[model samples]
Target: MVSTRTPGFSRPRGRFTGRTRTPAPTSAGPSSRPDRPRLGLISRDVPRQRRENTFPPTPDRLNPAHLASLRSVQLLGCAIAAGWAAAFPIISDLPNQRLWGAVAAPAYALAGLLCLILPRRFAARSAAAVGLLGAVLVPLALLALQGRHQSEVMVVERSAHLLLTTGSPYLQHPVVVTDYDPYLPAMTLFGMPRQLLGNGDALTRVAGDARIWFALTFLACLLASWRLLRPSRDRAPLLPLAVLTASPLIALALAVGGVDLPLIGVCCLAMALAERDRTVGAGLVLALACTLKWTAWPALPVAVLLLWRLYGRRPAARTGLIAVGVSLAVILPSALTRADALREQVVRFPLGLTAIRTPAGSPLPGKVLAGFGPTGHTVSLALMTMGGIGVAIWLLARPPVSAIAAADLLAAGLAIAFMLAPAGRFGYLALPVVLVIWPRMAARRWSGKPPVPPGPVGRRPRPERPEPALPRG
Candidate 1:
C-alpha cells in the first residue's frame, strides 16, 4: 500500500496556495456570517482568505445537529413537500411522481410533528419508523396493489417480460414515456419477480410490485454498503431506518417509482468497497450499477483512480478490467439484440433528441434552455457534455485517493449532469443529495467520537515547498 493509513480514510487537508488574495476583515462582514461554520471539502488546506470569503452553509443541507434532528427534518420536509407533490399532478403533462406524495408528505410531517411535540430525542427516531410504515409504506403498498402508480413501474415490468420473451428489453418504436425503455438491460432484474408472479391478486400484486423490489434492493445495498464503511472498533450506528424510509425524496420515490434508487444504492456499496481496498469487489458492484444506467458510468473511472492511488497498479488494473468486461458482457448483447430500439429509446429519448421527449421537464437550466429551440437544446446538451468532460479531466489530474473525496467529486459531477441535461427533473437531484449526505451521516453515527474528516489518502500531506509559480493544469 502507498501509505499506512487505512484504505477507507484520508487525512483532511486544505488546498490553499500562498499567493491567494486576502479578503476584507471578518468584522466588516454581515452580522450573521461571523458564526457560520465553513464546511471543509477536498484534500488541501484552505487558505484563510478563502475561508473568510466563503458563505454560511445551510443547516439542513450539510450540517444537521444529529440523527434525531434528521428525523425532524424528514417529517418537516414531508410537511412542506405537499406543495411540491401536489403541483406535479396539476403542472406536469403526466402525473408521474404523483398525488401519492401529497398523501405521504403530511404523514411524514405528522411523524416529525409528533417528535417535536413530545420533546424527547429517542421519541424522534422511534416514532419516525412508525411514521414510515403508517405514512409512506402503507400507501405505497396500497398503490401497488391497486395499480395506481407511476407508469415507470409498469414500464420496467413490461421491459422485463420482453427481455424474457425476446432478447432485449426495448421496443421497436416507443412514442410515449411508458413505451420507452431508457434503462439498460440489468434493470430488467428488478421486474422479473413481478413478471413471473403475474398481477393476479392484491397480495401478489403488492408482493411482486416492481416498486417494492426497487425499495428492497435500495435498502439492502445501502445497509450492506454502510456496514462495510463503519470502523470495526467503533460500530457507528447507521442513519436511522425510520428517517431514511420517511425522507421526502425517498418516500416519494417509493410511492411513485425509483429504478434509480437501486442503482444509487449499488454505487454507494461499490464506493464503500473501494474504500476498504476490496478492489475486485468494488469493480463488480459498480459494474452492476453501470449496467443499470449510463449515469452510473462515471463512478467506474473514479474507483479506478482511487485504487491506483492506494492499492497500486495491478489491483486497479484487475478492477478496471473486471468492471469493463462485466458491463460489456451484459450491454453488448442487449445492444446487438435490438440495436435500433436501444438507440431510439435509451440514447435519443433520454437526451431529448427524439420527437417525443421525456416528461422529466422540471424547468431546470437544461430543460429551460432546451425549450427555446433546437439550437438551445443543442447548446444545453453541449454544456452538459462539457461539464462531464471537465470533471473527467479533473479526476485524471487530481484523482481523489479517499472515499469521501471520491463521493464528493462524484456528487458534484452528477449534480452538474442533472442540472445541465436537456431532459431533467427535480427528483433526479436525489442522486447528488444522497451521495453528499450519506458520508456525513456515516461519520456522525457514533455518539462520542468526532466525525471522520475527508481528505488525501494514505498519509498526512507533506508540507509543500513554495513553487516558482503554480504549475498549469
Candidate 2:
C-alpha cells in the first residue's frame, strides 16, 4: 500500500522493534531552567535572604481599598513630618529633636511625596519602607551612637539606679525637673538594661539606652494586640504597623524619649485582649499598663465598661478585679515606703506645684495658664477637674459596648486631660491620637471595614442588611 507509515523513524523493522523504549527526561538539575519549578533541593542553592524575600505576596496591590488606605496614611504622615520638620527649629531647641527634624523628617516627607506622586501603585509599600528607614531607624541609630537622648532617658536610668540602691525609684529631694523620676515604679524596669549593661562601648551604650527597652515594650504589645485581633497564622499587618510606628506622632518621641510608649502600647494590648473575652489576660495586661503610668489608669474603666456592656457582669468583674488588684499590689508598697518622695515626683511635680519649674515648655492652653504663677495654676487645675467630671458622667451615661467605642471614649478623656494638665508637653498628646488610630488600624477595620458602633446597653444590636444588587436590564 503506498507506505502508510511514511515518516522517517518507522521503527526500523527488526532493528529497533524487539522492545519499545521510552527516553528519559533531560538532565536539567532541579530548577536549572528558569521556567522549571523549584524543588526542595534547588531552594537550598538560593541565598537565604533572596529566597525569603523572593515571591512576596502583593496583596495590597491587588486590593484597591488597601492600596488607597496605604496612600492616605503616607500622605497624612508626610504632612505631619513636614510640619514637625518646619516647626522643630522654631519651637524646640533640643539638639536631638532639631537634628532629626532637619535631616530625617525632611527625608521622610520627600520620600513620601515622591512615592505618592509616582503613577505606580506598587510604590506605596516602597515609600512606607523608605519613610520608616529615614524617619525612625536611621535617626534612632544616629542618636544611640552619639549617646544623645532626651533628658527623660537620664531620669529613667537614674531611677533604676536608685531602685537598686535604696529599693525606691525616686530621689528624696529634686533640684530640677530632670532630677525627679516622673513615672510609676514599674517604669524603672526599662532602665535596668543600662545599669546592667554598663555603657562601655557604642554598641553597649545603644543596647543600654532605655529607649530601646521602651520601644521593645511598645512593639511587643502592639504585635500581641495585632495577633489577638487577627488570629490567622500568616495575617500579620506588619507593613501598616511599621508605617504607624514611623509616623511623626510616634517616631519623633521614639527617637528622642519615648517614655510614654510602653504605657500606651500596653493599654492598647489590654483593650484588644479584653475585646476577645480573654478576661484574665486582659486584666493582667491592663494591670501592667496601670503600673507603668498614671495615664493608663483611665483605660481600665473603659475596658471594664466594654466587658460589662458586651459579655455581662461576670467578665467585667473578673477583668476589673485582676486589673485593680494587681496594680494596687504593685503601687501600694512603693507608695507606702516612699510616700513623700513619690508624692513630690509623681503628683506635685506633674501638677506644677513644685518649687522647681516644669521643663515642659509647650504653649498649649494648660501649660500657658500654669506659667502665670499660682492663680493660673489653680484655674488650670479647676478646669481640668471639671473636664474629668464631664468625661466621667459621659462614661456612666453611655458605656462603650464595642472596642472602637471604648478606644474613642478613652482617647477623648485622655486628650482632655492632657490638654488641661498644668504641666504637659505637646508631645504628650501623641498618646491620645495614637490610641484613637492604632487600635482600628491594628484590627484592619479602618479605611476598609467599618467597626461596630456602640449600641444600647443590655440590648442586642440589629444585624446589618446587605445592599440589594444593581438590577440589569
Best by lDDT: 2
Candidate 1 per-residue C-alpha lDDT over 180-235 given as tens digits, one digit per residue, 9 for 90 to 100: 98888999998999988888988888888888888888888778766775433234
Give lDDT tens digits, candidate 2, residues 126-159: 7678777887888888999888998988899988
Which portions of model 2 miss their true places by more than 4 Å?
Answer: 1-73, 117-121, 231-234, 446-473
Which residue window of length 10 is worst by lDDT in model 1? 19-28
TM-score of 1: 0.77
Cα misplacement distance, residue 196 of candidate 1 (Å) = 1.4
The deviation in Å at residue 292 for candidate 1 is 0.4
lDDT of 2 at 211: 93
Give stretches of model 1 more than 4 Å off. 1-98, 232-239, 445-473
